[model samples]
Target: MELTAVHEHVWVIRGAVNMGLVRTQGDGLVAVDTGLDKQAGKTLEKAAKEIGLPLRAIVNTHAHADHFGGNAYLLSRTPVTVYAPEGEAAVIRRPMFEPEYLWQGASPLPQLQNKFLLAQASPVHVEYTPGVPFEVDGTTFLPVALPGHAAAQCGILVHDVCFAADAYFDPPVVDKHGVPYMVDYLATCRSADSLRSVQAAWFVPGHGEPARRPDAVIDYLKQRHEQAFQTVLAACRHPRSLDELLADVCRARNLAPANPGAYVLLRTPIAAYVTAAVGQGRMEIIMDGGKLQFLTIEK
Candidate 1:
């Protein structure tokens, strides 16, 4: 397991779903986020042993399987308190399973299916709410509320570190058109923007390396998002089918057609973008029978 010190007290285990360990006061340990599968448990255990800290609590940023899949393994072996967003706790504790998070435009993996099934066999007990402050093992944690990405995702604020989950990635992921995923662009921007008030010196992302100066990344993502939103609005001068809009947008940006599932995956965020734009009077949606088409409102 490759453990990198992201901050003074926070260490990141770079694997499938970067796990974090933060040392609290009085030799108490806080497991910020767990990895993707059972193998992640082994890696976390190894890292914990290296630090010689007892794992007292595990705080999940959200309910995504990638961030919480190892819950069963970690909770089973250690007498640890597991915490998650209130909206996600019920789903996590239920022995049944849902898709967890939807992925569009990606190849299906059978291994993921088996892992979800295995995780459903047992549920963890700890849960929490946004903006709520609590203490465990001598350290205080403030759950910063961030919506749009996930309903109840909370970025953790501890000893000069904010574990900013998917709200912001270190090296932003470009879309098929070399554009960033700005579906919830505005909300995500606001979330990161609000983080400016936080006292943290560094921020850790779920999928990428930790960030010291996230201002540039956040700015780029916001700019790309506004550009994408404006582009969609310009193309919607006349009513356009979703497929037509996707094609026009994809072509104007010169995106490739490699994955068949990309279409489905992009729809959720795209629809959200359209919804927000429509609400703001930048665009409007017309429903003909069951078919929905979008048009830009002329200024």
Candidate 2:
């Protein structure tokens, strides 16, 4: 585990995915997101020991396994108050857990599979409000709602550095692939644009190194998003179907089809981009025998 101090009270813990620890003015600490599997508990424990503080609160940015899988374990160790996005909180409290909806065909992390399968979805103790201030251990964190990544995803701003959850990707994912999967592609763009306006000393992404300028990441996302849209436009010239579009996207990107789940997740943004273009009169979608086909607008 590695720790990168972004501000006087905030630190980013890097492992399989980045987790955050913030020192409150009073006592205790607030953890944003959790690492993958049981390792997250270990990582948080190590971080707390190193920093010499007790955990006071835990905030889950979303309901992804890697982000929230460690909740059961971490809560078992510390008496912490937990908060999650309202949409995500519903999933966490559902009576019958369904992994297929969230992660189809993907194997659960060894340490967390049982808890996720058997645990009851409980009501959210605390709900998130965009740009609303919440206090933890005497430190106030502004929870800014960032949708598109997930319906109720949020980002945290402590003074200047924004802990931008999974709204943006890093490393092998975005750095290498140059694209990200967002349920609402256009909304994702708007969210990134809003984040870019925040003049912060640093921004800590969910997956990459702490960034000093949000503009760089926003610019990268915009460029890749447009490129992907163009690729979709070009591929749809022949009235290609969704599956066909997926195939072409994978082919053009050199992605393996063996991982259809991953491919679908990655292609979701392309699907959204195409859908958006069609809605805005920039492209046309024709229904042929129950299948939709796309065509770019001329002009």
Candidate 3:
């Protein structure tokens, strides 16, 4: 991975997942996030060393394995202090919380325990509050709450640059993942709306190229949420169980989850979408033949 300067002191290593770096006082680098695993951590450390900066600290945007999985490895090499949101701290300190949650709070299946969802345990030295500015070696980074994608995901801002970690995605990403995973569709929409007022010279997303304008990405995200919500409502014309409804949604999107991980990944978000629809009175639940099902509420 190669590190390119985004601003005077901000840099990003773009890959399947982007790792952000902020230059601190005295040639120190604070990683906005470390990528997937020990290998990813090694790559980030090497890239920082190439630029002549010692890795000093890590600010995990969320607890997702892919985003913070490299934390432990990086911490092992350089005893840097780790700062993360209060809500996500437990999951970071105990990697299994992620896969367990995906398994509906039961013991996660072996299929769900992979490094993609369960990262190495990393200590959280500081549990930060959202919208607070924290200082690291005389450089300040503003952590803005961007929930929904993950309940406690955040985007860090510094020097006219916004390191938006999975807050929003480009249109192509939306097109690729038809029913994009999210914890709460409404909260994600709210975060996208919040992005409207942020003026930055550069906006860097965890998944795509840096953009001067965040409008297009935010708009595309909103459109995808609406499309997914409508698809769920339409699929509920007849009373259908969650399983049947999810299958209908998958068929409509031309998606066939081929693995247990992919199945749960899609299932959780579909449930959120259904709950949102039902909460707004656009859909309703009923008991059918001893099975619980959802149906569109006649307007």
Candidate 4:
């Protein structure tokens, strides 16, 4: 992991995750988000120590395993406290909640139990309120409510730099996965609009490079999400089951899921789009032939 100084007091690890480090009045560093697992946490700790920055605390943008998975490892070795948005904090405290919900609240399959989806439990020492300036020692972080990816995610703003944790992916990382991984279609779109107005000098996303002006990147994300939603909506005209709609959208996009764990999760995006359509009166849920199906409403 490489730490590049973005601002005088703000530095970011530019790799898979744009993990942030904000120097405080005491010169200690506050980690924006931990990485994938223990090894990532170890590397991060080593990186900070190499630069003479002692770890003080962590602010997890969301409860997704990849973002906060290293929290447990860091807490095990360091005295750093963790802060997360309330609903997300609840999930991080009980890491299994993600996989359980993904698997319809039943026992999650072994494939869904990997570090990618399941991380060691992490304690949330603080529940930050969005739109409020979160204080850590003498440092103040403006935590913006960036829901959609997770129920309660926040984008931390410090030193004129916005640590937009997956609020919108950068160009190369946009739609990296076949299906858009979102829980709520409308919320995700609104968040795209919200991300563009954060007024930060630099926007560092969880994936891809930081952008000074991210209009193009954010627009691309919106376009892709619109296409995904429209694809699902179009397929619903024929009254298809959720799985069938997923297949139709994937086939139209010429994408293949990497594994069963991934395929199962794709249902979320599909359901999100369908739910939006239902809310907008463009689609209706029905039961036909003992199967749940979605049908486009005739306007």
Residue lDDT tens for model 2, 99-165: 4443444553343234433343434578777777888777788887788777678888876778888
Instruction: Summing lDDT over every window of 10 consecutive residues in candidate 2, give the lowest-scoring window.
Output: 95-104
TM-score of each: 0.84, 0.87, 0.97, 0.97
lDDT of each: 0.71, 0.73, 0.88, 0.86
Q: Clashes in each model (backbone N, CA, C under 3 Å)? A: 4, 3, 0, 0
Candidate 4 backbone clash number: 0
RMSD of each: 3.8, 3.7, 1.1, 1.1
TM-score computed on alpha carbons, candidate 2: 0.87
lDDT by residue for model 3 over 58-171, one digit each (tens)? 989999999998998888887899999879899999999999999989999999989989899999999888888999888888889999999988888888999888889887
Model 4 Cα lDDT, one tens digit per residue, 1-299 = 78888898888888887688889988899999998899879878887887787899999999999899889898988799899997889889999998998888999998899998999999999999999887886899999988887778889999999988887887566656756577887888788789777788998989888889778888888898898888888888898998898889889998788886788778887888999999999998899889999999977
Tell me the lDDT of model 3 at 171.
79
Residue runs of model 2 more than 4 Å from their true location after superposition:
94-123
Cα displacement (angstroms), candidate 1, residue 8, comes to: 4.1
